[model samples]
Structure formats: structure tokens, C-alpha cells
Target chain A: MGEFELIRNFFAAAPCAQGGEGVALGIGDDCALLAIPTGEQLAISTDTLVAGVHFADPCDPFLLGQRSLAVAVSDLAAMGATPIAFTLALTLPTVTTDWLQAYARGLSLMAQSCRVALVGGDTTRGPLSMTMTVFGRVPNGLALTRSGAQPGDLLCVGGELGNGAGALPLVLGERTAEPAIADPLLAHYWSPQPQLALGQALRGKATAALDISDGLLADCGHIALASKVAVQVECDRLPLSSALVAFLGKAGAQNAALSGGDDYVLAFTLPSVELPPLLAEGWPIHVVGRIVAGQGVTLLDSDGQDITPQTRGYQHFRESP
Target chain B: MGEFELIRNFFAAAPCAQGGEGVALGIGDDCALLAIPTGEQLAISTDTLVAGVHFADPCDPFLLGQRSLAVAVSDLAAMGATPIAFTLALTLPTVTTDWLQAYARGLSLMAQSCRVALVGGDTTRGPLSMTMTVFGRVPNGLALTRSGAQPGDLLCVGGELGNGAGALPLVLGERTAEPAIADPLLAHYWSPQPQLALGQALRGKATAALDISDGLLADCGHIALASKVAVQVECDRLPLSSALVAFLGKAGAQNAALSGGDDYVLAFTLPSVELPPLLAEGWPIHVVGRIVAGQGVTLLDSDGQDITPQTRGYQHFRESP
Candidate 1:
């Protein structure tokens, strides 16, 4: 079959493409038609992941596919929008049915899990890469943004941190770990789930929010600049996974959790009073810091010593290749 | 500045990125928030252009930028949707300030011309490729899809074709032309205007439609398969521009129009009875063929003799790398 037919038969034939909520017309069209309901808004994001840059070139096709969609969907999760549809622009060096099938399986698996539909896409001939543009919906004026943090608000994270970064040693073939440590760390690196539920639960409750992609410190700095408030992150209070601690050790794990990249956890700010109900209801909200009146971010020791961050997270252009 | 800062300052600083219609929030966020009108449905499409495969690597970045956005927006035009916003995913091997400034200028020019805004995007270091996902809005049940044709419907085109295909020889340095012929062909190649207005006029009138990116005959095959109707194209009636004929001669231009790709024109089917009024309004609609009873497409000469196609348009996988 031709490339277009490959896209039609494989990617477009998935369950989500058969017509789901908001998708008026799915594949086999110039553009996918989506009906946005009244009193709602569409949240859109685009992310490109390149082989050998974003991940290893010869990595498992299934894992690559899963990681690709997961990273892009995390943006929507940060916006507190319900998943709707996504378009995949895939470029491959060669047409290998095995690779395509595995990739499609991984993409389909993630689509089903996230409740996202494959609306439309184009397949091309080039180096290995994928660019995913996802669309979701949120009620008007209710989407969470990184520009609403206020002084005296509590800063919390939805899940454990440093797992993705802790997997780097194993991912690059520099280290080995026991299954107890390896399983969770590798899972976090390959398939970090977007906390869509937590984002929705925070809707108007959290004053500011964003997914932790570029590490906790860098992304929280985004909140600080946009919300124009200072943030104090307690080094002792970070919620590191047990697997990560076991894999990287205490001080190393602490550094990775605060400064390492690719953690898709949610870091948000809300009133100190609002945390109890969510915590009481068994949400995974771990309070790590608080918003202050000034600007910039300050890292503190357990003893309240001023041990501000000396290192920054990954910035694509600034780093040497 | 970092990659994110580069995007925010260079691309996000474009006029279109600043609070245009339907865009509630634009760049500098996890996701761009857009509000489709009460009765409108969202139309989405994505297209990727890679250096060396889609275009020459050393080609003008400015023209590449213009062509990239134009190609994706053409799909929106074909869907009869008004352009709203677009997200650009750019993967580059190196950082060149001058190249980015020129490219952004070209992108901003087309975004302004097409009335589309820059919403959100991600920039990364990798092979040179750009993926643009565009969004637009159309009234419910009014999108012009490629699935509604019937027998006896008059097949027409919105504007002249073959110019883009006819430009390939010159684009690849295989041939050269005088200014009068070369300029139009080059423009058609680098920056063909999307027929947004023509598509809007055809909304409820035309039965089925799509932009002719994959040349006429192959795109006609798309309508045939989707709508389950036969299409017949008369070679003598194709609307070719003087510039194409001057560059490639009559026979060569006709072959290019029939078999070559990258012509961003609209092809549609409407009843012969509905043509007069649209024509009288001077909308540039040219009748070229008719829908027939059987399936697939048949190419005919002025003598009304059948000469079905032996060539297909550009399919990435089918092409020899």
C-alpha cells in the first residue's frame, strides 16, 4: 500500500477515528471537522520529538510512540482540558511494516488510555521523527494557566518526581538496576502519564498550574515570571519516588528530582486551606513549597537555609550538542 | 536566549500572535486556548515539509517558511473554513538568527494574508523539518468534504493548475525561464495562495471538494473513492496559465497538470445547473469535466476518447529516495 493508504488503514482505522465526542467528521478529509460545544474553548498544542535528540534513535518503536504522545498530551493535561483529537505528522527513513505496526500499536494504546482520537495526519519520507498536534476542550474561562499564582498560596505536585531523570543512566546504557528500581524508573521514562484527572480536579481551585517537563525548578520559574510571584521550594520536601531514590541515592536523587528533565508531573499552586480536602480525599497532592510576594524562585533546605538553585533545567538551544 | 525564549520573542512577537479573533490565549502558555463561535465547528489539518525531500536544503528560508504555512492552510481553504490559528513545529540542525528572522518574516506575511494566527509551537534541535498544524472554523454541516459527489455533477476547478508542477524543472536547476514565465511559476511553487474565498462560496453549493495538492487526476481519484462516483477529465478543457505554457510548452504543461503534484488549487463537483450564477459572479470557477456512473477516474481528449491515467501523483513511499 502507498503511504497515504498506510495512514488511512492503520492510524485512521483506530477506534477513536470511528467518530467520538466533538469529532463531526474524522479521517479521509482535507481537514477533520470538530464540533465545539457552546460555552467551551479548544486548547491546542504542538510538540515535535526527534530521534537521537528527544530519545535514542534505535529505541523500541512501541516505547517511542508511547513517549511521543505522552509528552504532547501532558500539555493538555496542564491546561485541564479533556482530550478530544490529535494529528500525527510522521516522517520515517524507510517503510518497514513491522516498525509502523508497532508504532501504531503504541499510539493506539495511548490514545485509548488518554481518551484522545486520531483525527487526521500525514506520513512522509524523511528521517525518523513525529510531530503531534493535540486538541482538547475546556469550559470558557476555566482553563488552568501558569499566570494565576498568588502570594501565600501553597505549591504542590500531583505525583512523585525524579523517576524520568533517574532512568537516564539505564536509558543511556551506563547503569543497571534491580527490577524493583528498574521497572518504575523505565516506566516513568517511557510512559509518563499526564495527570489529567488532577488537572481537572484543580480547575478553579489551583491558582496556577503547569506540567513538569523541563524539571520542577525551570517550569516553576515559568509560573513565577508569568504570575509575577516568588516561589520557595523546600529541598527536603520534594516528593521523589522510592524507585528513583533506590536507583540514584539520596543527594543524587534530590538533584535529579529538582533539576533533571522529562518528568510529566503537575506542579500547581493553591490556597494552603484548599490542600486538606484534596489530601483528605486521597489525592496525591504533595506540598513542596509556597508562593511568596517577591519574584524569582528560592530553594530552601529543611532547616530553612537559603540554598537557592545553582543549576537550571534543559533548554534546547542553550545546551551543547 | 533559550529555545523557548527564541520562539516567544521571534515567532510569538508576530502581529497575528497578539489576541486575534477566536484566540483567547496564544503563545507563552502550555497550550493555546481558542473559542469557536456558538454555531461553528473547528477544522484542523497538519502538513510537514522536510529539507532535501520536500525542498532543496539551501533554498531561501523565507520562501520555505511561506510555502510551509501556505500548503497547510490550503487544506483549511478546501474545507471551507475561515482561518483561525496555526502552530509551527520547527526542527533545525543549527541556530542562525538571520535565517530565523527571514523565515519568521515569510511566515508572518502568509499568516497575515490568510488571516491565521500563531498560537503555540515547539522548537527542537534535529534534522531540518517543519510541521504546521492549522485550525479554522466553519458552520455546522457546511464543510466541503470529498464524499458527496453523484452522477452528472459538473466537475470544476477554482483556479489555474499546472503552474506549481511546471516549476519543478526550474526549481531543481534543470531549466531556466525568462522573468515573465519564471516569476509566476516560482510564486506558484513557493507561495500559492489558498482559495479561501472560493471555498467559502462553494460551501453549501458544491457537493464535494478538496484542494488539488496531489495533482488533478490523483486528487480526483480521492473524490471517486470517497464519494463512490466516477470522474471524467477532458484534457483540452484544463485551465492552464500562460506562464506555464510559456515555460513548459502546451503538451508538457498538460502532462504536468495531469500527473505532477503540489498544485494547491481546489477541485469540486456541482450540478451543471448551479454553475451559471457562480460564473456570472466572476469567481474564477472553470468547468473541466463531469461525474459519471462508474467508479475511478477517466481522462479524455478533445475527441471524447477515453485515455485513463497511467501515472499517479507524488506518493512519498512510492518515490525513489
Candidate 2:
């Protein structure tokens, strides 16, 4: 067998590629088969990460394996879909057995944790990059979308935000700290857990929902435009993790929470009546702001003054105007 | 809006990104939603094309767009599934308006032709590469697989072959040919049609099926290994297009037909009873061999002697075994 064929076999033998509940056929086929039950809709999303662009060039492959899948699966979480399967299209500069083994192990562990099967994908030789496409099943007409928020909806988040962006300095070796603060931040960066359970719980409850990847303010802008309502963010209510606040000062952490991307925390709009039961059920629903009858996203200070910054979030490409 | 956001709008406004039959949600969302009919299984496949490895780096984005999607959708045809939707994860080093417009046009044209909707995708800054993940649906328990070919089945191809490999020399500008010969061959290489109709027609008739991406003989070996039967190809009966034959003489064309890796034609095994009706229906079914109680694939001469070549097909990453 050829080397790439061996690579295929390696992935096929991974624990995640083993048959799963909805997977009719896993790896080793032209196309993987998935059986979505009647009255359910399939949620699909694609994400691509490139070396030196999305992450450090010489970073750990195991961490990359986990982070890539997690980032893509987060979209399914935004849609409140139950995880089903994912396909990875990996492009590498060269073949290394150790790298492949470590990457597959990390992928398998994450897949097991998320209950997502590894379906079929292609491996090609090229500049280092990976594209992951995730699939999930959601009940028909019950999916939380970005265009459903009403004027009086309350804006909430699943958990603490900005840890991922705060870890960037440590990830790039530009800063160092005691392991206590650094470890948690690094873990959050390498493996931000997709809020799958919370998203599913918010089904038929959340008016508008999305995982915060392009920062809280910019993503709220997405919801505002799509739903045709204004999203008002109260800066004092932004959830800042203890680790993030310890690493970056209070003001820095707040700035990161507002504009630093890669949080992967679900920022959603919920009605006041739905919030009580969800909070009573021990879900980590943090109220950050509210939806109002306006056109765009507005950042308000404690005194109810507009204090929006110039840079909203990380924009990937600065093209010629 | 940022440049990448503008890029997103460019694709979102494309014709293929508009809603379709099975697409519950198209672009401009965290996840694209698809609604499969009751009693149907979703077939998913992913393919990646790197600029330098898979195609010329400075080649036309329009043709690259067409070829990338077609190559992925071919997997659905192999599984006898009706095309539904696809997502593209595109990574480019820089943003160019002309390139984006032409590429989107090509992608939309091909998507419309194949009746597949462009549901969603990601745009990132990196070296040029495109990963396409395609989705399709087939009746439960009726999708074609590579493990069901019986010993008595006849191996058949959907149409003519080898034009793709024959066009390679012309593609690289190493050789020139008459327009009549080169046009057909180049078109075959750039935009080979997925036999979706033929695949659905073979749903219950053909025992095993797959699109010929890795050459006929090598792909036949795949069927042999999966079905635990031997596939014998009669060299004299191999199908060849007139354009390919004119470009490369008989022996050269025959070799290309045996090991050309871009055919995208369906190779399947059918019982003798099923072939007559399919042929009478003018489905371009070309019988080239038969299955037997053996372990691997074998190429036969006109005198029925074994003549399998050493190199079965193109194997990416020729690492040490």
C-alpha cells in the first residue's frame, strides 16, 4: 500500500472512526453514511485552519488536532444540534508517523468527548492546513438561529469569555506566568469545549443564538443585523474568568472580552420567562446585555454611556478598499 | 465590513448559495441546515485541492472552482445518492476581486448543473487551497457500497475514460495538439460530469460501485479487497474516447485508461440480467471484465494472460514501506 493509503488506514483505525450511533458507514468509503431520524434537520458547518495563519507553525499536532475539531463543532453547538459526525481534510507538507499517531489520538479523544464519529476525508500533500466539516441533527423548526431575537430579549452567555484570546501571549511564548494561571488559560485556548449541552437545552428557548468566535461585540453585531434589532452590551456584566483576569488586568481582560476573538462561548438572546427555568436548572447562563429596538450593536458603560472602541474584533484580511 | 466579510458576501450572493430543495438554510449563518426526507440516509464526503500539488498554482480560478466541487460530488454519485448541498472552506494568500468573481461564477455554474446547493463555507488567509464537503441522500439500506460484488457479476464503466490523464501533457504546456483533440481532453480534465442519474438508476441493480478517481485497475483492486473477490479486466475491451485515442495512440491511450487518476466515471459490478436492460436504456454501460473467486485485481491480455502493470495508479506520498 502507498503511504497515503497507510495514513488513511491509520485514521480508519482510530477510535473515533469506529462505528457510532448515527453513522451507517464510517471511514474507508467514497462517502460516509449518516442516518438522520425523521422530523430532524441536519446542521453542517466547515472550518479551516492554516499554519502560521490560524496557529503557530511549530505548535503541537495533538493540540492542533483537538482545537481544529473543537472550533468546527462549536458551530453545531450554536445551532443547538446533537453531534453526529465530522470529516477532516488534512493537507501536510510531509508524512511523519509520530505526528499522525499523536494527531489521531487527540482527534479520537475529542471525538469521544463530543460523541462525534470521524467520517471519511481526503489527505493531500501541500502547505500545512486542515479543514474540518462537522454535522449534527436538530429537531425541525426548533433550531436556534441568529434571526429570531425580539426587541425585549435578554443577551446571555454560557460561560466565561476571553480566555482563548488571553492565552495568545502564552501560546506564542511572549509572556510567562505561574502554572496555575497559565495552565487554565492555555487549556482554554487549546481546547475550548463546545457548549453542546447548553445549546441543546436552549432549543425552543433562545430567540437568537451564536457561539462567540469573532469576539462578543462583533458576533452580537451579526445577530443584530440578522434579527433587525439592536444588541446593547453592558461592559460591567462581561464574564471574565479568574485565570483570564489574573493573567491580563481587569481593563485588559475587559478589552479582550469585548474585541479579542476565539472565545467559542455561546452568546445568545433569551426571553425573560425562559431564563428563569434555564438558570434554575444549574446552567451557566450569564446575563451580559439586552436586545433593544434599534439597528446595530452598542457598547454601554456602567453610566449608560456609549463607550464602543474603534476596533470591534479581529478582521482576518485587510484588503485594498 | 472587513474584506473577508465582503468575500463572504460575494459567495453568499452567488446563485448556488440561494436556497434549494433540501437546504433548510444556506449562507449567512453559523451552520447550514439540511432536511433529508424520511427513510433516507445522508451521504457525506470531503475533498481538498492544494494549489501546487493538485493543480497549477497560477491556473484559472474558474476551472479550479469547477474541478474542486465536481471531484467531491463524484463521491455521492459513487454511493448512488442524489446531490443535496456542499460547503467550501477556501484559504487564499490574498484577496483579489477578479479571482473571487470568476471562481464564484464557475462554482455556481457547476453547482447548478449538478443540482447541488452551496450551503456554507469559511474564508481564511493562507496559502491557496480549497476543501469541498458534499452532502447527498439515498433511501435507507439502498446506497451502493464496495463490499457487495458477487463472484458472478460483470464489471462495467459508465462511459469513456483516459481523457483526463491524456490531457495532462497539454495542460502543463509540454505538448500541443489540434483544438479538436485538446479541447475535448481538457474539458474532460477540468469538468468531468458526475453520473448522478446513472448512479441513482443503479441503486438496486448494481451490487458494488465507486467513481474511478484512482485509475480503473487500482480502483478495481479496492473493490476486490472490499468484496473479497477478484476483478479481471479484459484489455481488449477497455473503453477509450476518440479525443484521447487521437492525442495518444492506441497503446498509450490504453495505458492511460488503465491507470489515469482523474476519470470520475463510475465503475460498478452488475449481474448479467441487469446489464441488458441498462444497456437497452442507453446508459453508456461498457462491460470490460468479470468478477471471480479470487483475492485481487488482474489485467488480462487478449489471449487471457495476466499482464497487470507494476504501477497500478498514482499514489500520493511515496514514503518508505
Candidate 3:
């Protein structure tokens, strides 16, 4: 079989959906097509993760596949869009059946969880890299934006942070992999759960919303600048997993929560009133601080003393190759 | 003020058609939204061009912009779909205002030409590379397929082939630029006129269709294998431009035409009742060969003797980095 036929056999398996506005056509074409509902708008985002840049070279292909799709789909969550379909661009040194199978397995698992269908993509011979372009649907003009936060809005996060970054050392073999530290960290890094339901629930309730791909402090700063408001993050109230606190001390865990990256949790601002039961249950919702009618972000200690951040999250420009 | 704002300003200035049939929302959001027509399916394709890989590092930013979009859009054309929107992932070493402006200009020009709007895409600080994911719409179950060609069909091409590959030496400065030879070749490379119109015109009429990005012989082989048929090309009937002939001798031009890449013209097979008016207006439609009930490609010389191709097009696995 030629390249095209081989691709069709392996990657062009038909997209599956159980009713509710699914993919109209998936794979085996120049582009996949979807049919969005009348009141919905398609949400789209693209992200590229290069081997040795985004993830370690020897990392499991399955984990890479899951993380790659999760990261792109997280953008949809930030926009309060419902996941629909995605396209993957994979550049590899060569076609290895074993590697492809493992990678496809991971990708299919996450896709099945989110009801996201693999639509189409290209495969080429190059340095290992994966670029996923994800598509979602949101009600017209209801999608959350970073500029929507008001001065009195409460700063909130949907889940624990820093576990992904705190677990990185173990994943890289720099630190010994203990079950207490490795399992959660590996889970956080390998298979991040995009908070699509939480985002959709926050459609009109949250004043501003964004995903914490970078550190909490840096991503919150995005809200501050975009909304032209001041943000006070109470460091003591920062959410941390029990595993994280035990592995890295309380202070170290706090540092990771504040400055670590790769936690695809929803960071949003809402009114101080009680949130919907749907959003408050199962998901960990922490009230870190509140927005003020000013600009820039400020961190506060339990005693109301100003605290300076020693490091910010990953900066594409400043990070060393 | 921040990365998000920077992206907003950079892309918002480009012209975009607002509130079309498929586009639910344009730019300035985490993801652009599209509402696919109810009965139609979407076609998608992605292509990546790296600096010093797809084009010269010092190549014109405008031409790079044009060619990058053109190459991706050509895939949609090959599928007999209508262009809708695209996302661009640009990784740059540094932000150069002049370079960005020129690149945006070229990108906007092509986007406008095809009426496809620029949607959401990511930007990163890394080696210069561009990945474009293009979207198009086609009627349900009506899109052309590479695997649809059958025996007894006529193999045809939309326009002149190999000018882009022939111009490579000049573009790399390995040879001096001569207008008689340089202009057409460069134009063909820089601003490829994707056969969208021709492709749309061939929807139900043609058996199989694809763009000639790799080269006539190589891409035709793709169709043959996909459709499980044999393809034969008439050497003397191959399309040639006067400029190509003037620059390179007959044999030299033939070799380039047969083996060169990056010519995003359409090659399709149709019944041989009446040819399209592409040739009468000098747009370069050549009936090079025919398909038979077998496998692989065969070439015939001027005297109808079987001729072997001296060169084959670029192969991703075989090319040296």
C-alpha cells in the first residue's frame, strides 16, 4: 500500500458520536466537516509541542498523545466551548507501528472521554512534533473572555495546581519515583482532564476565565491586564494536593502552585455569591482572592503583608533551549 | 501590553469577512467559532514550512506568507471544497516589526483572495516555522476522493507543471535571476494559484483529484495506488511554459517538470468526452495519459515507446536534512 492508503487504514477510522450534533465527516479527506447547532459558534485553537521542547524525548508516546490533545482542548474549556473535533499534525523520524499504536490509544481514550472525534491531520518525516488544532462549539457571544472580569469579581480556580509541575522532576528521573509522589504527578502530567463542564457552566456566571497552562500568578496577571483591574491573590488560600504538600513541603508546594506550569485547570472570576451546585461539587473550587478597580497583580500573605514572586511560570521567550 | 494583546493587535488589523455562512465568530477570542452548514461536511488539511526547509531562510517574508497559505489551501481545492477559514501557528526567534508586517500582508492577501478568514493560532519563540490548518466546506457525500479513480479515465492536469521546482536554483541564488526565466518560475513558486475553482468545477465530473505539490509523476502514482488502477503518461504531451523552455534546454526542462516539487496545481482524471476550456485560454491543461485496469504508472515517449523517468520528485523520507 502507498502512503495515502496506509494513512487511511490507520488514522482514517470513522469518527463515532452518539447523536447530539456530531462530526459530519471525519478523516479520509482534505478537511473534516462538522455541523454546529444554530445557536452555537465553533471554537478553534492550535498548539504545537516539539519533542525535547514540550516533553522529554524518551517519554511514553501514549502520555505525549494524551497531553498534546488535552492541552489544545484546554483552550476550548477556557472559552467555555464544548469539544467537538480535532486535527493532529505529527512529524516523526519514521513510522513505527508500535509507537503509533500506543500514541493512538492514548489519543483515542481522551477523545472518547470528551466526545471529541479525530477529524484529520498530516504526517510527515521530520523531528518529532505534534500540532493539534481543536474545535469546539459555544453559544453566540456567550464564550468567556479574559477581559470580562469586573472589579468586585471573586478570583477562583477549579482544581489543585502545581502537581503537574511539581511532578515534573520525577517524570524526568531527576527525583526518585515514589508512589506517593509519582502516581498523582504522572496522572496530572500525562492525562490532564480539561474542565469543559465547569467552563460551560461558567458561561455567563464567571466575569473572566482562562486556563492555567502557565503558572497561576502569570495566568491571573493576564486577566488583570486584559480586564484592566487589580488582582490580589491570597497565597495562603492557594489550592494544593495532599500528595503535593507531602512531597514538596507546604512552602515549596505553594511555590509550585504559584509558579509552576502545565496545570490545565480553569481559573475564573465570579461574583462572591454562592456558585451553582453543579460547579461547586466534585471539582475543587478555591477562592484565592478578589479583583479590585486598578491594574496589575499583587500577592498577599495571611498577615496582609505583600509577597513578591521569586519566579514566574514558563515564558516562551526567556526559556532556554 | 501583554502577549494576548500583542496577538490581538497583530491579527485584528487584517481584513476579514464578517458573519458569513460558516463563520460564527472571527478573531479576538481563545478560539474562532464556525457554524457549519447543516447538510454540508467540512474538509481540513495542514502543511508546515520551516525556515531553511521549505523555503530559504532569507526568502521574502511576503512570498513565504503567500506560499504557505497557498500550499495548505491547495489541499482543500484538491478535495473539491470551498475555502472557509485557516489557523496559522508561527514560531519566531524574535519579533521583528518589518518581517511581521510583510508576512501579514502576504497572508492577508491570499486570505482575502480565497475569502478565508484568519482564525485563532499560537505563537511561540523557537526556530522559525509555520503550520497552517485550512478549512473548507463540501456538500455531504459529494467531495472528491483520491481513491475514486477507475480504469479507462483520462489523466489531466490543471496548469503548467515544474516551474516552481525549476526556479529553485535561482531562488537559492545558486543561479542568477533572469526575467525571461525567473519571473514565471518565481511567480509559480511564490504565489501558487490553487485550482479551487477548477476543483469545485470537477466535483461530480471527475473520478479522482489531487494537487501536484510533489510533482506530476509522483502524485499521479498516488492516485493510481489509491484507486488500484494503472496510469500512463504521454511524454510529448506534457505541459511546458515558454519561459521554462527559454531558460532550460528541452531535456533539462522536461526533467525539472517531471521531478520538481511545490507546484500547487490540480491533477485530476475525467471521462474524455470534452476537455475544460483551461487550455484554450492558455491555462495549461494537458491530457498527458490514461488510466487502465491495473497498477503503477507507465510513461510513453514521442514515438509511443515505453520510457523510464530519469528523476522522481522529492520524497520526505529520502530527502537529506
Candidate 4:
């Protein structure tokens, strides 16, 4: 075999690439085989992170590896699907064994945390980037979708929000703080846990669901658009992590919670009655707002007055509108 | 919504993104849901192509779109799986409406040709590259694999090879030829038709199968290593298209067939008893060699003398042995 094929061997030897439940066959094949249970639908999502575009070029490869898989797996959580397997197509300007080993370790850790196996992937030389396609399975008619929310449903988030956004300054090396403040924020930035169990818990209870990648207001707008109902965000109720609040202060943290992206937290609309049972079951269900009769999404002040901002979240492109 | 999300809308409106058979949900969701049939396994593969490495940077985006998806689907074909759907993770240096339209059109055409839906994808700004992940379904215990070859099996290729390699000079603007030769070679390079039907036909018959992306010899070595049997390729029996021979001469075309990469043709090991019926049914089964009780791959002259070349095929990295 050529030297390049050895890189593939390195990945093949990774713990996560070994066959796991639902994986009929893993790496070393032209195609990996996944066995889906009868009556289950496969959930698939693809996410790409480009060096310099998605993260700093010199950022930690280990963190990059963890973040990449975590973000992709979050989509499965949004869909309320059980994590199955994932394939990564990685491109790099050059091969560095040190970088690869560290990256693979991070990937393996995330795969274990998310309960997903590394099934197959392609490795190539180019500008550094990676695309992860995650697969999951959910029973037919049970996978969560954004189009099912009703007018009276309460909107909720899985847990704390804004930490990823609050951590950006630190990640770009523009700011530094006490370890107590920076640690949690940086951890959220580099290793956002996909709320898979919470998503599955919300499957039958949630009227509509999605993971918060594009800030809270913008992602809520997606649900409003898809469900044909207005969403009201209670700005006062927005969840902010302690580290985020310490770093950005109340107003900045609140703004980050409202308009920041990359949170990777589940946001969903649920019937008010469904909340108590799930909350009692210990799911991290945090009420953030409600669905109303109007169209589009609106942010409301404590007095319930309209206080929406023009720029709701981060946008990578500026296409003609 | 931000202008950048419109790029997603552009793809969402493409013909291939519409829900099709086995697609429970298509675009505009956190995850696309695919319904896997009972008693069938899902086959998946990912392939990435980077500008300047896999193809010319300034080459036609339309052709790039087609070639990118086609090559990825070839892996499903190698697994004897029925086409279902695919996701695209596209990274671009910048957004160009004209480029996006042409590229989407090309991708749509290829998707239709392969009968696979564009279920979902991610579009981001970065150095130009794309990763395609294709999903297909095959019956349990029936999918073809690369580790099933046994001694006394006939080594075969689905059709003519080396056209992709022979067209490289023309693609790079270093050579010119008549339309009869150049047209076919360029077509092979830009739009290889995955032999899905042939692969399905070989199910339970061909002991081992894989698409030839790493040339005949190198890929044969993969089969030999996996199946623990040596593959003998009779150089005199190598199949070459008239166009390839016309462009590169017989010896050059033979060399390309042996050592050049990106052919995207299926090579398989089938018991000698199974070939006649398939050939009778009009499958382009070409007997190139045979499997023997040994290790590695061997290239033999007309007189049956060993003549293996040193460098087998393309490799992106050179790691220490």
C-alpha cells in the first residue's frame, strides 16, 4: 500500500471506527453498511467547517475535531433520532502526524459521547476543512420537525444558551479572563454537547424542534416560518451561563443569547402541559418564550413590548434580499 | 432571514432536493430523514474533491458538480446498493450566482441520472471544495464487499478503463485530439456512469467487488489484501476503449489502465461459473485475470511473466513506512 493509505489505516484503527450497534460494516470498504431497525427512518445531516472561515486557522486541532462532530450530531438531536454513525471527509493543506493523532483522539471522544461510530470517510489534500455527515434512526412518524408547532405551544431551550457566542472573543484571542469565567465558555465553544437524550425525550412532547446554530431569534424564525405561527421570545427569560454572564455582563450576555450563533442547543416548541412531565423527568427543559397567532418571530421586553433588533444573528453570506 | 441563507434556498429549490422515494424529509430541516426498507441495509460513502488537487481550480463548475456526485455514488454502486439520496457539503471561496446556478444544474442532472435525491447539505464560504455523501439500500447479507474473493475466482472489470487518465492531458490543455477521441475521454473523466446495475447483478455471485478509483493494479492489491488472495492481471487481456487507444496509443493506454487512477469502473472477482450468464445478459463483463492462492497483485505479460510496476496509483500523502 502507498504511504497515503496509511493515513486511512490510522483512522481505521481509531476506537470510534470500530463496528458498533447498527453498523453492519465499518471502514475499509467502498461503502460502509448500516442496519436500520424495522420501521425506523434514518436521519442524516451534513455540516462543513472551513479553516479561517469557521474557526481561526491556528486553532487547536483537537478542539476543532471535537467541535466539528459535535455540531453535526446536534442536528440528529434536533431530529430526535438515536445516534448511529458518521462519516467525515477531511481535507488538509498538508499532512502532519501530530495534528492527525490529536484530531483523531478528539473525534473519538466526541463519537463516544454522542454514541455514534465512525463508519467511513475520505481524506484528501487541500485547504484545511472537514465535512461531517451524521446518521441516526428514529421511529417512523416520531422524528421531530420544525413544521409541527401550534399557536399556543411554549418555546423552550434544552439548557444554557450564548456560551458559544460569548466564548468567541476568547477563542480569537481578543480577550482573556479568570479561569473560572473562561473555562466554561471555552469548553462550550470547543465541545458543545449534543442534547441527544433531551431531544429523544422531547420527541413526542415537542410540537416543533431544532438545534440553535443560527442565534435564538433567527432559529425561532425558522420554526415560525415552517409552522406558520408567530414566535414570541421573552428576552428576560433567556438562559445565560454563569461563565458567559461573568465574561460579557448582563446586557452583552443577553445580546449574545439573542443574536449569537453556534450554541448547538436544542430549541423547540412544546405544549404547555407537556413541560411539567418532562421537567419532572429531569430533562433540561427551560422555557424561553411562546408561540403566538401572528407570523414571524418577535422579541418582547419584560413589559411585553416589542424590542426586536434588526440583526438577529450571524450570517456568513450577504446575498441579495 | 439573512441574505446568506438564500444560498440554501437556491439549493432547496433545486429539482433534486425535492422529496422522493425513501426520502421522508428533504431540505429545510435540521436533518433529512430517509426511510430504509425493512430487511435492507443502508450503504453510505463520502468523497471530497478539492480544487487544484482533484481537478483544475478554474475548470468548469458544472462539470465539477457532476463529477463530484458521480464519483461518490460509485461507491454505493460498488456495494450493490440501490440509489436513495445524497447530501452535499460545499465550501466556496465566494458566492457567485452564475457559478451556483450552473453547478446546481450539473448536480441536478447527475442526481436525476443516478435517481438519488439531494436530501440536505451545508454551504459555507472557504477555499473551493465539495464533499458528497451518498446513501443507498441493499438487502441484508447480499451487499457486495471487497473481502469475499477466493482462490480460483475470475478477476473481471465491468468495461473499458483508463479513459479518465487518458483525458488528463486534454483537460490540462496540454494536448488536443479529434472530437471522436477527445469527446469520449473527456466524458469519461467528467461524467463517469457508475455501474450500479452490474453491481446488483453481481450480488451473491461476485465474491469481491470494488470500483476502480486507484487504477486496476493498486485497487486489485486492496482486494488481495482484504481477501487474502493474490490477483493476477493479464496485461494482454486489459480492456481499453478505442478512444483511449487513439489518444494515448496501445502501450500508453495499457499503462494507464494498469497504473492511472480515477477510472471509476467496477472490478470484481467472480467464480468462473457465474460469468457466462451475466455476459449473456449483456453485462460488459471482461475477464482480465484470475485470483490465486498467494499475496499481493501481479501483472503478467502475454507469456505469463511477472511485470509489476513500482508506483501503483495516486496517493495524497507520503507517510513513513
True contacts kept of each: 0.93, 0.92, 0.53, 0.90
The candidate, 1 or 4, that scores higher on TM-score is 1
Stretches off by above 4 angstroms in model 1 are none
Evaluate candidate 4 and give its CAPRI docking class based on DockQ: medium
| Pairs of residues clashing in candidate 4 | none
Q: Report the Cα lDDT for candidate 1.
A: 0.90
For model 1 chain A, where is the 10-residue window of minimal lDDT? Answer: A12-21
Give the candidate number with the greatest DockQ: 1
| Residue-level lDDT tens digits of model 4 in A160-236 | 98999999999999999999999999999999999999989887889899999989999999899999999999999
Q: How do all the candidates rank in terms of lDDT, highest first?
A: 2, 4, 1, 3
> What is candidate 2's lDDT per residue for B161-273, written digit by digit as tens?
78888988988888999999999999989998999999999999999999998899999998999999999999999899888888899999999999978999999999999
**Root-mean-square deviation per candidate:** 1.0, 1.6, 3.6, 1.9
Distance from true location, Cα of A165 in model 1, Å: 0.8
Q: Could you give the candidate ranking by TM-score, starting with the highest?
A: 1, 2, 4, 3
Q: Which stretches of candidate 4 lie over 4 Å from their true place?
A: A1-4, A319-321, B1-4, B318-321
Supply the TM-score for candidate 3: 0.88
The superposed Cα distance between candidate 1 and the true structure at residue A3, in angstroms, equals 1.8
- Candidate 3 lDDT over B185-254, as tens digits, reads 9888899988888888888878898898877888887888878999988878888888877777787777
TM-score to native of every candidate shown: 0.99, 0.98, 0.88, 0.98
lDDT of 3 by residue, A1-321 (tens): 234544565567533222324676566545565776766777888998877667888789888878888999998999999998888877776777778777887887788877788877877665677788988888888988888889888899999999988888888889876797679888998899999998988887888898998899888888988789999999999989998988889999998898888899999999877465645565567889999999888899999888967665676556364
| CAPRI grade of model 1 | high
Clashes of each: 0, 0, 8, 0
TM-score of chain B of each: 0.98, 0.98, 0.94, 0.97
